[model samples]
Target: MVTSFLLAAAAALLNAQEPRPVEQDGHVRPNIILINTDDMGAADWSGGGSRFIQTPHLDQMAAEGVVLTDFYASANVCTPSRAALLTGRYAVRSGLARGVIYPHSDYGLPQSEITLPSILREAGYATQIVGKWHLGTVPDAHPLEHGFDEFFGVPYSNDMSPFPLISQREVIEEEADQTQLTARYTEAAIDFIARQAGREQPFFIYLAHTFPHIPLYASDAFLGQSQAGRYGDTILEIDWSLGQLRQTLADHGVAHSTLIIFTSDNGPWFEGEAGVRGRKGDTHDGAYRVPFVAHLEGLTPPGAVSRAMAMQIDLMPTLARLAGAAMPDDRPIDGRDITALLQGGQESPHEVLVFFDNDQIAAIRTQRWRLVLRTFYRNWLVPLEQFGAVHLFDLETHGDELFNVAEDYPDVVESLSARLETLRSELEGLPQRETPLNLPGDE
Candidate 1:
């Protein structure tokens, strides 16, 4: 049974703004499609400065839409970032801040939390997820239970064992063919859009791709087709998938009414290039910062570039506003609506963005400053003792985070540190599940 609090919240949100009627003016609610790539670096695409990987489709999106230069993933890794992205709350709030969800884990995203799909569904949109879902593996944590009407993809990362292709609730394939994952996901997404061609209901497709992560695979047509080898080939295939989606939307005459957002879950793992210092699992900009491009044929201006600071958590509130859904007032939502920034506004919706390394508060960034609260192992061969616990960097002058400005600006450190402590206390105070769900006879 659905909780009363959720029912009440949905009612309030639905009442906040009536769903716009489908009209010929093209001002109807836009179909929202989020294309999330796995373990893709900030500079993996051609538009982001990759010389080897040919991402003509992605470059076209950047050329014709708004490119967010300072966008970030909520966390440096997978599960937590995904949690924050869907919930509009920090991963810590979901009790998924510690690490990635493993196959053996029995717990998943809490049902008590409201996801973007849940809110959008209340606002009369068809919600579907067509890619990797790392949040949880159990039935209670499945995407269908979380309000997505359709679920057609893998349950977790492709690198995880016993990876199977799932269609709704059934495991269609015991072991999925990794090489065809991107193509299959794109076909599914296109099919979903085609089915909604003439329907009044606008759709929300969370098309999360499974590739470009470790154990890379590419179809025969794209293999060895890049100077950057297998990694580049995988990205090219992703680019192809994007092209297919765009063409299909245009063919169905819904291209102009669709808002397409392309980004990565986090930074690169072992391959790909990041403009900044660290890679995945680190709190540095390289790990958290990912390529962000928003394309809406009539809404977003062409050739617009924004340096505004935004994070994955912002998608919930932003999309809610776009879909005529109001945010739930019962809980604290960390993400702010970045609609203005996407449409060519200069001001960032965020004053400060927090970075987490697992459950620990690793760093925090303002527009021109970043403060490191803690440091952790970053898969570096060097001794961990070489790093410090607290450090500050003037991002405007030194974007690489090479030099420490903590000694020069003691006041900035003190202020950010205080804010971090307050956030920590707030998160710690939230009610959480007492323990992970145990299977039938587990001790």
Candidate 2:
């Protein structure tokens, strides 16, 4: 009798109209903490990008987690790139076409756009942004206005310092000292984490460190820890913050449950940091490609390195998926969820990345072949922003050179020219591209 009833039940369930949901355990979700530094490079540390600078915190995280060998940042400028990250769509789809938020422009990230915080918060995570919210500096263009539960830091760029900055909904602190501001950001994050911990809720903290950007400053402890001088000393302070954060999580017994990420917004400031081409607005590999590392106690594998094509835009969907957030269905997203690789699920992922400096220049890279349009990496964000007019190069032989990527592969150049036109037409014509801007939104 029992066997007969069981057979009937199985049959009924199989014949049900809707397929069973892919059930993800939502019991104890992981907390997320993302760290984004300004204008840093891959080799600026001991791991992948640089051999000189000592980014111990970033390096340690790489050793204990996944290191993307070829992660691209999509756009070469700060504003467009950041917009791409928040929306998970190309920046061109929004009104921002180039470098960053205008001084007093009211245009910020369109409210209708979907951001990582919106998705995660919907999934029950307490999302807060603490540091360098460069999406906009307008009255309505704030992180809280987007989706963050709290926002405390510069609404514009760090170079815009020595002026009042925003704190959540208002400009509470203006022309705040760099050291004090950073400490406050860290303190805010720690407090946010503590509050979340007390409530036993998952929290998403975006600790945007404004250190080592420019007009560099440091507290007494890190005043002179490096032979590299003030810049190096600034990095030491950054490291100190990381150590403290890690310890804070551990002290609160949430270290094993918190995911701490360390990375930069872009390559090192070219003018500020020597031996690097293109700093703030160049399209060179150095400008758009920055260091990225993700580490968590239970989920991430330690000391892993991956050469897969990763980008800042991918973080949106990845974090949302990890947080079990409901994704928006209104618009198309260019980012992919590489949770498998991050969790040691796969050694490699299949995806290509598109990079654009500005409307005048662009580049695309597949697994091996790369197409460089007429643009060098050493342009933009300067007093006189000059587009390189037109130049192409083969990325294979000229990976180190900034200006000539097509000199060797004439075939690649021709292929890229045709390919680029097709891509541009397709991306531009997409209905998801709602707010067309004067520029191609850093293409």
For each candidate, the alpha-carbon lDDT, in order, equals 0.83, 0.67
Report the Cα lDDT for candidate 2: 0.67
323-359: candidate 1 lDDT, tens digit per residue: 7776899989999988887877778878888887766
Worst 10 residues of 1 by lDDT: 1-10
Root-mean-square deviation (CA) per prediction: 6.9, 8.6
TM-score of 1: 0.89
Q: Residue-wise lDDT of candidate 2 within 305-338, one digit each (tens)?
A: 7666678888887777666787777777888887
| Model 1 clashing residue pairs (backbone) | none
- Once fitted onto the true fold, the runs of candidate 2 whose alpha carbons sit more than 4 angstroms away are 1-28, 49-52, 271-278, 344-351, 359-361, 376-398, 402-410, 428-443
